[model samples]
Target: MTKDRSVYIRHIYDCIGWIKEYVQEGKEAFLQDRKTQDAVIRNLEVIGQAVKDLGTDSLTASHPETPWPQIAATRNFLAHQYLGVDLTLIWNIVEQHLPKIEQQIIAISNDEGIDLNAPNTPELP
Candidate 1:
């Protein structure tokens, strides 16, 4: 893969990792608590940053299965305006959308011959 593609894939993997972490712990419970909403929004911001850094063009052109623009926009909203962040919507996206997107990333990586088990991979932006 080209350097840019490799970077994007790494970003996707990082997002997947974050999602897994959120799910594994009881972090999902935060979605229902208004008090923990800020933390959830913060994590979503990270997810969005990774998506934006991955870029829409290459992702759409190559990995059409992923919704790059929507992901980036979500990230933008979370980062730029925390007050506007909707907890319910964020919760739904985390519970419903992220897992599927994660699977697609893994599939694409395997198809492109990426080694997920490789050591010291660069952090995705």
Candidate 2:
């Protein structure tokens, strides 16, 4: 059986949202704020874990080119040694990679005929 695509979509949304808030003051602020780094990194971890939990079929059928494994591996790397996490790399991942992920997820949801604006944006745990 396959997991709901919305769950993973929500994860992507969440990660993106957190990054948005973190970067409100711009890249300079994000680079200087330890708290934002912690929050963003954890959300990135969730995005990866959620992607891993998604069914292989859904991913292969729709978002086939996503680097799901690499995303998950990044989560593991962050979790084990967060003290050494790279700000530039995290910024790159959040600013560059996540929007693409979010776009792909939205495309998949639209293809499935799911209403993205439905009143059920689950809060990140």
Candidate 3:
């Protein structure tokens, strides 16, 4: 069955949270740990998938500042080019892109009246 838009919104929030949790030890720690790198990469892919699922047209129009297309593209890159993943690019994304995304997702959620912390799906680690 198809999901509600809020479900995808929550997924984006949760994935960002998971990425933040994985990188809590900071940049050097992240760069040194393959498992953390892998976790962040996987969460980014999930964020992309959730963004794609949320449907680009309306969401992009609503929040034009958000880079919906690039986020989805990142997901595609991660899925297809997993073997050649660039740690620097991923690190930059975590350090930079995600906060903006997290903010925009919050904006989208508030504007759309979706409670991210609501009891819908189980939270992922």
Candidate 4:
């Protein structure tokens, strides 16, 4: 069964938070640290997948300005083009786009009355 849309939003929000934390040292550090690059890329992948799982209808209607398709495309490129992935593009995305994306996600969560910061634990069977 599909999970709630809020769950995906939370995942995206959390991933962005993690990415920000990982790159706190800035561009030069990020470029030099392979571990940080992997971590950020992994979070980016998660963000893209979460966006894909969240689907397009509500996202487009609620936030038409958000680049949902491009987000998903980035995930696809990261997942498939591992060898050819460009650090510069990833850095640019983090530096240039993530802040806006983060704000948009916070707005979406607020509009839906979902607390993105809340604990998201699964129920036991």
Candidate 5:
């Protein structure tokens, strides 16, 4: 269970790094490229899965700043709603939102004294 605790944090870091890498071409390029869009969506799904795995109690006790419900819901939206997927909002999430969460993850990892950058299954951001 102790190791499981880090799963969500690592997952968040992984998603942030992956999203950053996927959107290197900027939002305009991201919006135009279907493969990039798919990659981003899949990463979001992984992030949401991590959030869901973290659960409410763990999030509140450890990293309460994360909007766990919204993260999980967004994952559901991306995974389930294909036709209604909004590229613009996703762009906003990646460009405007990811950095903030990335910082938050870094802060929490620092406070916990965990080396998130240490090599793991997906490798940390």
Candidate 6:
């Protein structure tokens, strides 16, 4: 439904905001601390859940570049196998993949006529 899509889009926007915040102030610190690592992992889980909730149609049809499966799998691994989670791999995702994902979200929002600079936008968890 339209409401569901709106929620998913908001989640995507929130994830992008979190990524930006982490990159801006926490990137170096996150790379050095376990607590920061865990926090970022949690944020990734939130993003992954949002992506999963969007489903394949929303991801592939509406936002083709969003990597929904990988996001969902990451969420699963973090939630169901936390002990086996790899910080290095997570760090790599943050450093390499997040920027592209953010760009894609921004592009999708623009295409859909959503304003990225709007007031009172929700912050990412």
TM-score for each candidate, following the candidate numbering: 0.71, 0.81, 0.93, 0.94, 0.84, 0.76
Q: After superposition, which runs of candidate 4 have C-alpha atoms over 4 Å from their true positions?
A: 122-125
lDDT of 6 by residue, 42-80 (tens): 888887887778675667787766676887778888888
Candidate 3 regions with alpha-carbon error over 4 angstroms: 122-125
Model 6 residue 85 distance off true place after TM-score fit, in angstroms: 1.6
Whole-model Cα lDDT of every candidate shown, in order: 0.69, 0.76, 0.91, 0.90, 0.80, 0.72
Residue-level lDDT tens digits of model 2 in 23-120: 87878888888888888888888877777787545576667787767776777888887668888998898779988888877887788776666644
Displacement of residue 41 (Cα, Å) in model 2 is 0.6
Residue 100, candidate 5: how far off, in angstroms?
1.5
In candidate 2, which residue ranges exceed 4 Å CA deviation? Answer: 1-3, 119-125
Model 4, residue 110: what's the lDDT? 91
At residue 33, give the lDDT of candidate 5: 97
lDDT of 6 at 33: 73
| Poorly placed runs, candidate 1 (over 4 Å) | 1-4, 25-28, 32-40, 120-125
Clashes of each: 0, 0, 0, 0, 0, 0
lDDT per residue (tens digit) for residues 9-111 in model 4 = 8999999999999999999999999999999999999998888888866688779998888897788899998987899999999999999999999999999
Tens-digit lDDT string for candidate 1 (69-118) = 88878877777776576666777887788887778778877888876655
lDDT of 5 by residue, 1-125 (tens): 23455656777798789889999989889989999999998998888777777675666577777676787788888988888788998899887877877887788788877678766664445
Task: Write out the backbone clash pairs for model 5.
Answer: none
Pairwise lDDT winner, candidates 2 and 5: 5
Superior by lDDT: candidate 1 or candidate 6: 6
Clashing pairs in model 4, backbone N/Cα/C closer than 3 A: none
Better of 5 and 6 by lDDT: 5
User: What does the lDDT read for residue 83 in candidate 6?
Assistant: 75
